[model samples]
Target: MTDDDPISLPAHDWPEFPPGLVWLVGAGPGEPGLLTLQGLHALRAADVIVHDALVDGRILEWRRADTQLEYAGKRGGKPSARQRDISHRLIELSRDGQRVLRLKGGDPFVFGRGGEEAQTLVQAGVPIRVTPGISAGIGGLAYAGIPVTHRDVNQAVTFLTGHDQTGLTPAALDWPALARGSQVLVMYMAMKHLPKIADALLAAGRRPDEPLAIVSNATLPGMRVLETTLGTASHDAEAQSMEAPAIVCLGRVVLMRQAIDWMSQLQGNPPRNPDPLGGGARTTG
Candidate 1:
């Protein structure tokens, strides 16, 4: 493809992507450097890139001059392009013999609506590639100095969405089971209905004092981490004011922020040792 053509990596740097397929590549949580090697290769080879709102912009700047970039972000509580429309657009681009890359924030299948898009492409007889990235549930929390798993803390981790497609608390919500079962609960799109969700968790058996942490813009310069508890998640979210694309983690592991938080150390603000198992200091909001 010539320079005027959609973006593409040269024959040497990027491998050629099949023309008849769409690649679903996760952009990771925030840091552009966190992109997987395969993910970067696809971005460089793509003729057309349809990226979400949260996909790291720094990463997109790496696209070849021939690439075509389109915004298909579906932000919560905002007028969003229809999911069907986005899927069909991918199909159209591929049918035109263009290599399309659907770049999403975090893992595509991790509440990124990647499964729905893949289903649409499959039904239309289009081929696809799924490249995984670091999900915010884990990566985001990590940046805030929190660990989702520690032998001494949580033995299992459960990831869930804070809102359903209709923008409510995942109406078919099963709070009781989630509260009673998981050791660590990581939530996406949680900033919106955090209060209600936290309440439900408490009412369903989660200890009111259970530790919780919210990390916003994980791995990015503006990233902020709020350490709270199940009962205070909503209130602290309000007081400190977190926003969309943030990750919420709840469990004994939340208390680890003071112990093994490596990101802060990298930023030169390492958390003080607070004894994860002791401090009644539950972070919120």
Candidate 2:
């Protein structure tokens, strides 16, 4: 409601009378129910919603019939709207005096480039607002029964992208420190080059026997988690064949899945056999 203080509730509670401009809203992951009240409000009030492919369809139900909807998804290694073009479009929409809603998956600022869009709008002298949503790193992990942090395992968590456009790990990433630094690691858009990323972590001193859980289609009804050790995650994921729009988590906290495998059991699926080493499997790659 005030500067230096962000509204912490869901999208619905956001102040109705907003500044004349754009609002970058996160739609959470794939689940419609996960949408923040603020996100819901944006959907209803938006004159236009330029959204990504990752956003669920049902969330649009609350919108007025005349609201304009546009797509601007950027999947890894896929054709997407150019970032600059998208930014320019946002400016154009706002210049028309339309309340624009830039809907993104997960928290817009968390790897969603919401900040970049915000910067562009600000530089263009367009007013902008932000609303946070559930990040895949956390909500997605929960779908896989992998906790980001546990008092017994990790007190801290780290989030990173597994690779860059070249299909190689990001050189700018201080991997050596990150690999050795955080107690728990969560990676987004890492499936394509998971092997290289995993190897980097191993070389950087993380235990190969560490637990890894790859949650695909997180928070959706079809969400799947491949449990493995760091050394074998890539292979096992390949063996069973994992798909994208996934989240990968690593650390001892993953073991909690054993007691909390209720999602699987409810679906009549049983746990797989334990590895001979008494350690869980890794599946980042």
Candidate 3:
């Protein structure tokens, strides 16, 4: 083939996608373009696909015409499929010789319960492969102009879920420890209990006025970033009527957004470089 030909590479360069096995893939945070090449390959090759609630439906447009799509999304307080049932279904599909694809939103291993499903499959002797995707904690925050780490701000960052399996604040989390130890905190699925979670952080000595940002529907067309503080996050979120599938970040990194809010700049807003810390402007000799 000539250099200008679209099909210049041989088919052998592609990896083998064997049947009767399951691939756990992360679809990334809401953006269809964020889906990895491996994930797209599996989508086109798999006989069946079991996906989560946060996955963008448009990503499935590339799937084969005969691909079987199964919805196993779990949203807090919404009627959804049970995790146990979903895991069992994967095992059943694999045993039936189907090339199953367990697709999840964000990194499957990051608060996606992918480990549990993988364990279940291992115990049942089902073969599996794992593909990592850009997590909302990282990608979504970037879309809102918030970085998880910056040398001038913090050296450590913590990522945690706002709730546990019971849909309440994770009781097992040592709130005081996290409050005292972490430089930056990135939370997922915490909006429903923002009041309680905020109280815990405050009680553990986090400043009420600490810079905090809530990014909803991150990386998607409807994305919104709310600039607030630890003290007013819950109230502001309520007042603004923010929705779920959001990422909440706290610490000086949130302030950096003022200088590098690229998304807003793309929309014609000017960049801002405000004082992240309230130490006032510096004076040099």
Could you tell me how far off, in angstroms, the CA of residue 283 lies in candidate 3 after the best superposition?
20
TM-score, model 2 to reference: 0.87
Better of 2 and 3 by TM-score: 3
Flag regions of model 2 displaced more than 4 Å.
1-13, 17-19, 165-167, 265-285
**Weakest 10 consecutive residues, lDDT, candidate 2?**
1-10
Tens digits of per-residue lDDT for model 1 on 33-69?
A: 8898889888877889999999878889888887899
**Per-residue alpha-carbon lDDT of candidate 3 for residues 1-285, written as tens digits (9 for 90 to 100):** 112322222354555678879999999999999998878778877899999999998887677777889999999988989999999999999999999999999999999999999999999999999999999999999989888997667889999999998888999999999998989999999999999999999999999999999999999999999999999999999999988988999998899898779988989988776555545445653
Q: Tell me the tens digit of each residue's lDDT in model 2 across 56-139.
A: 877765666778899998887788898899999999999888989999999999988899999999999999989999999998
The 0-to-1 C-alpha lDDT of every candidate, in the order given, reads 0.85, 0.83, 0.90
Relative to the true structure, candidate 1 reaches a TM of: 0.90
RMSD of 3: 4.3
What TM-score against the true fold does each predicted structure earn? 0.90, 0.87, 0.92
**Model 1 lDDT-worst window of ten:** 1-10
TM-score winner: 3
- Which segments of candidate 3 are over 4 A away from where they belong? 1-12, 274-285
- State the displacement of the C-alpha of residue 34, model 3, in Å, after optimal TM-score superposition: 0.6
